[model samples]
Each structure stands twice: as structure tokens, then as C-alpha cells.
Target: MKALAALALFLLALHPLSSSAQVAPAYHARAEQLLPLLGKDGGEKDFFSDLFLTAVPVNQWRALTADLRRQYGEPQSLGSVRQNGPTAGQVEVRYRRATVGFTLVIAPEAPNRVIGLQIVGAKQADDSLIKVIDDFEALPGQTAFAIARLTDGGPQWIATRAPDRQMATGSSFKLYVLAELARAVEAGERRWSDVIPLSHKSFSGRLLAYPDRAPMTLHSLATTMIAESDNSAADTLLLALGRENVDATLSRAGHAEADAALPLLTTAEAFALKMPANASLRQSYARASIAQRRAMLRDHAARLDAKAVDIGTVAETPASIDSAEWFASPKDEVALLDWLRRHGGEALPIMAVNPGIAPADAARWKYLGYKGGSEPGVMAMNFLAQAKDGSWYAVTGSWNNPAARLDEPRFVALMTRALNLLAETSR
Candidate 1:
């Protein structure tokens, strides 16, 4: 069982067209025709082709307009059309507050009505890297980001804010698990298709309801763990790989404060230990030395099972996030990604299975690999991208607030803007 994490909106798509048909200049006018319908009541039937209407019904199209209005206010003007092919063009619609760009593909024959439409990107007025940073700072809690260009020597910083400061990573820590898995595969110690039994379960993920000890392939576990943030899949993989090996990955991948993450706790343990009923145990575990804590985990392993987790207690304000949750810095994440990109070639496609951003935004990159994590007061997003110019870059950000919950969408939007800016800058 796998439950998908909502990364970003990927709009509709229709049948593929031939590569030879050149986009006619008239497609620009056709692209402009869509601007007026943003807040309009009717007329979708007149503008869109029958095939387009079949794919995206009138009601769904209207609902899309309503959502756009709510987020960016009413549409005002249209930007220039950039041709993609003989039948397709990209156009930007200027809204009351934000600028939205979408792709329009018209039917190949005469009466070239719209056959495909997909929203590709959106940005606030005067949106820039600095503006994005300012928005991150305006958030109520700690927010940090790092955008770096990877080189043969190492990561060369492009932009950074507290890049080395450790913060709760939530599920982003799975990347390390992935790194260690790749190492084992390359070392001939394990194979991706090797089958392993589900050794642990957690409160989150659809895998929680599955029969315990279900047999699954290593590749499937890693895929669901990274794409769906499936806790059980992650724990099963971690346990199978050996925790000490993953801990070794921490140092090998250039983690600055690896000790803070000593004795990596499985998702089940993290949840169970945060339960209100286990406060005394949690306190004791927090105070113990690294060696002592390892012994404690061994002795109390059963008590930290998913059955012991009280969702109500841990789902409220952050529960010992500083001391309990996985911690990583922006720089550490960049290093981890860089290592994966260079050595984990087999895992690259697994990472790209979910781009974690709008399909249009993701298309700008030659290659984009993503894994993000969020829980209550913590949100983290990390990306390993190859720009169209053949340059490799790493971008990562995290937000944490112990006293209150963080806004995931806001953080996502800001990070999206940063990614879009990076794409534009590199080009």
C-alpha cells in the first residue's frame, strides 16, 4: 500500500502531436483568446475543441478559473506568446497580483481550436530571489535555504541563508537512507530487486494498514518511501540496510553535525516517543549519551512500536522536534544530493518519479530529482537539478516553528519561485 504526498499541481494533458508541425503565428491569437475566460461565465465550448472539452469538462474548467481567481485575483492582461511548435505556444496571463504562464496546443487542422492546455508557472509581481528570501524571513519561524552549483571540487554556494544551521528535516532525511541503499547496491552487498519483509510500521502512510511482515522488493520500498513519504517503507528499508550503515552515510555525505542525528530513530519510534504517555521515556532518551541511547532503543524497541503512538498528542504543536526529529542543514542536503547524483545513478529515476513541483516548472530543467518532507510544525524541500545548459545545481530549504504549525503551501510556493528563478538565471 502506498499513499501519495501532494507535491504540486500538475494540470491536464491531451494526446501527443507530431513533431514536424510548426507552430503557426496565429496560435498567439489563439493563446490570447484564453485570457478573457478567466472570470467569465460561459463560452468554453466556443473556444476549446471537442477533444479538449472531453478531457477537461466545462465545470472543471470553470472550477479551475475560480481557483485562479481565489489565488491570484482576476485576470487583467496577456503577455507575449512564445511558440513551442506548429500547434503549440506558451503565453503568460497577467492577473491582478500574480503572473501565470500556460501552454496552449491547438488542433493541427483548420479551425485550430485549443486541444490541450496546461498551467506551467506562476509568480507574484516583481518576484525575485531576494523577494523570495524576504518572504521566507517574514514567516513566523526559522526558515533557511541554499542554492548551490555543484562542481568537480565540491558545492559552490550561489545563495545561502543559515545554510549550515541544523533544522528538523521531517521526511527529507529519507535521502540519506536512499544514499546508503545506493552504496550497498554499488558495493555488491544488496540488489534493488532483493525482497525484504516489512519490519516496521508507523502512524502515517497507507502501508500502516497492511498486514505486518508483508514481503516487498527493495526498489518498491525505496520508491514508495521517497515518492509517498511512506514511513513503514522507510523503516523497513533502514532496518534491512542496517542502521549503522546509514549512520556511516551521514559522515560520508558531509553532514556538518552528524552527532546530533546519532542513533537515527525510525518513524515509528519518533512518533511513539512523542506520545504524551511516553513523556518520561522521551525525556530520559533525550538526556542519554549516544552509546546509552543506542542501548535504550534496543531495550525499549517494543514500547516504540506504532501501537504506542498517540496521534492526538504528537499532531498538535511540535513535540521535541529539536531533540527528536531528524536534523539536517541546507548545505548538508546539497552535499547529500550531490553525492547521490554522482554515485547513485540507479536511484536517479526513482527520485525523479515525483518532481515535487508543477509539471511546467519541472519541465524547465533538463533533469530534476526531488524528495521533500513535512510534519506538523516542520517542512523541508530539496532538489537536485540539471539545468538545460548542462550545469548541475542543488537547492534545499526548511522551515520549523516549535510553537505553531507552519504553512506548507506558502513554503512550497516560495520554493517554487526560487526554482523558477534558478532556471531563468541559468539560462
Candidate 2:
């Protein structure tokens, strides 16, 4: 499962630039026009150009605005607008729940139609650690998080919520695979640049469409596995590194539920078992002992391939998340990060490829290595972050709901707020 928490990129419909002095007011006017339509209906066709509408259909536009309304409430005011050029500028829109900053671009002509709009950042009026905890509790389902501030002696627990309670962690479990790969490299068993044939395939990745058995480097697989949460890339690496070896990472990294995480399933196996067609197989695997489950994976390996997975059935709703998906506590995740920080040399850059937060928030850290994961009803985000003062911290969190889908962006916004608060402390 790919981490579905990326910041939404409003279409950047660029047009020819104009240097007219009238650009600023027209751009501001268009922004003002768009603001009032949020949380309402039927303004997308009138305000958006054919190009914009084509890229972002009317239904998507409606859903985006409605989501804004649901999360931040109606737009209360627009702050000072800073013009980037004749057709571009930025503004802060204050909503009932939060203030959101947006970069706006427009056509260089009369009416100055909106050509692009991107959410750059957001902030809340009563931002605090306590408030962050409160907001986490306010979310619809089970939530766990841990923040540890590092010092010379070691890590000090700064804040936490159910730190020891295990929850489903979508693709975030790939961090352990990364740790094991790094360990092998350090032991001289393999090199990051070592080449191998791409031998596994799964959905939610670019590799699934590539020619089978195409040659690729270990580093390339790790990059896509972490940076994009590529399922195929992950499965290929897991099999190459050896499942038992990767399983050892859990215990070595202080995973609280190592036994529960035993016989870790590849993306393909997970998808295959979760499909409605494999109910009996899923039940048998769930009830089996660790050794038995391992045997089951071996004996049933052929039946648990790409052909067995039904994407439609799996997407219908959350299926066996508690029983089938990766399990980790917030504290366990922090411990894993601590191990990686001390041991992960080459893997650090691969993790840093995706910051997992807004550019403004990510800039607060000297280095931010992030990996997150998500599915229909599960979401998790973890970071091994280094501050400007050479301090290291691990921030990890998860949200899970077995009965319904999750609001990924809403959870992301809350986590981003927590990170921003940490940035203030580091400075």
C-alpha cells in the first residue's frame, strides 16, 4: 500500500505570462471569488477555465471544496496577497478551524481566471502539544503516537498516546526491511549498487508494469520501496534479503509484538489473503502458529500470486486490518528509528527522498527521513528527523478504523501540526 498522505497538488494550469500592472488586482479578485464558493455548490464551471475543468473535473472540484469545508469550515477572511509575478501570487485564507496558505496562479488577461492553486501550508490558532493530543483523540477511530527528543544521554519521551498499544501500520513496516538490508550491506554480504533481476510484482508500484526479470540495483529497489511505498519493489527486496532475516529485524529493533509480526507477508500475499475469494485461506493463516503460518506461506505460495488478488473486493472496505496487516506500537516504531539512526548509513538518503510533509515544515529539520503507509482504513507516518542543532528525533503515529474509511489528509494535517511544533522547539 502506498502512503496516501501526499499533500494535494491543485492543478498548475499555466498560461502565457503578461506583465500588465492590472494582474495583481485581477488575481486577487479571482481568489476572492473562489473563496466564497468553498463549501457550496455549482461554482466550479463558472470560475474555472476549460483547461482547469478538464484537468480537475467538476465532481472533483466539488469534492475538494467540500473537503475544505468539512476540515476547516467556511473561509472567514483572506490575508495579504504577495504577487510572485504578473500571473502568480500567494495568499492566506483564514477558516473557522485553521489558516491555510495557498499559492495562486492565473491567466494573464481580463478576468484573470485561476490557472493554478496549491496549498502551501496551514496553521491553527491554538496550536500546542496538548492541542495536538486533543485533536488526535477527536479523530474518529483508534490513534497512537509517540515523540522522542534526543539528547547526548539518549532519547527522552517528549509526548505519547498509547505508546505501547499495537495498531495496523500500512506500508510503514517497510522500514524494518530497510534496516535488514542496511545490516547486510554493513556486514559485507551485499553492496547497495549490487544488481539483481526484478523477480516479484504487486500493485501500487511502477515496477508492476515493467518487464519481468528486468535488471535493477539494490539501491533503486530500496529507493522506490521507501520513497514511493512501491509494493512490488518491497516484495522484491524482501524475498532477496530473505524473510527470516528481515523477521529478525523486529526483535533486534525491540518490536514489542515480534511474534505477532512473524512470517511477515509480502504485498502479494497480503493482497491475496485479503480478497473475499480467499476467506478460508485468510482464516487458516490467521489461526495458525508462527511456524505453521510460515509453512502455510510456503505450501500455498503458488495460490497467493497476483492472479489471486481482487483489487475491487479489497477496496470495498477495510478487511482484516487488525488480523492481517502489519502491527507496531508507536514506541516500537521510535525504537526502530533509533536503531536505524545509529546503523543506517546508505539507507538514510533513500528515506530522505520523501520528506512526507510540506516543504516549509520539512525545512525546519537539517535532515528528515520519512516513510508512511496507508490503505482504506489504516494510515501511519514515521520520521527519523535531525534538527538544525544536530539533535535526532523520531516521530511516529497511526490511525485505524475497522468499520469505515479514514480521512488521510485530515490525519496528515494534524501530524504536520505536531511536526511544526517540534520545529519551534528545535529552533
| Candidate 1 Cα misplacement greater than 4 A, ranges | 1-8, 11-33, 39-74, 81-89, 96-98, 104-117, 209-211
How do the predictions measure up, each by TM-score? Answer: 0.84, 0.87
In order of listing, the candidates' clash counts read 3, 0
Q: Supply the global lDDT for candidate 1.
A: 0.84
Candidate 2 off by > 4 Å = 1-7, 14-50, 57-63, 83-87, 108-112
User: What do the candidate models score in CA lDDT, each in turn?
Assistant: 0.84, 0.85
Candidate 1: Cα lDDT at 227: 86
- How would you encode candidate 1's per-residue C-alpha lDDT over 262-367 as one tens digit per residue? 7788888898888878889889988888788889889998898777677788887888887788999999999999999898967899999888887878889999
Q: Candidate 2 on 1-427: residue-level lDDT in tens? A: 1111226455777577788887777877877876676647876766777888888888877777676766677878877788877678877788898777777788887666787777777777777988898889999889999899856576799989999989999899899999999999989999999998899988878888999998999999999999999998999999999999999987898898887888778988888888878889889888889999999999998889876677888976898897778889998899989989988999999999999987657878999999999998999999999989898999999999999999787788778888888988887
Worst 10 contiguous positions by lDDT, candidate 2: 1-10
Q: Lowest summed lDDT over 10 consecutive residues: which window, candidate 1?
A: 1-10
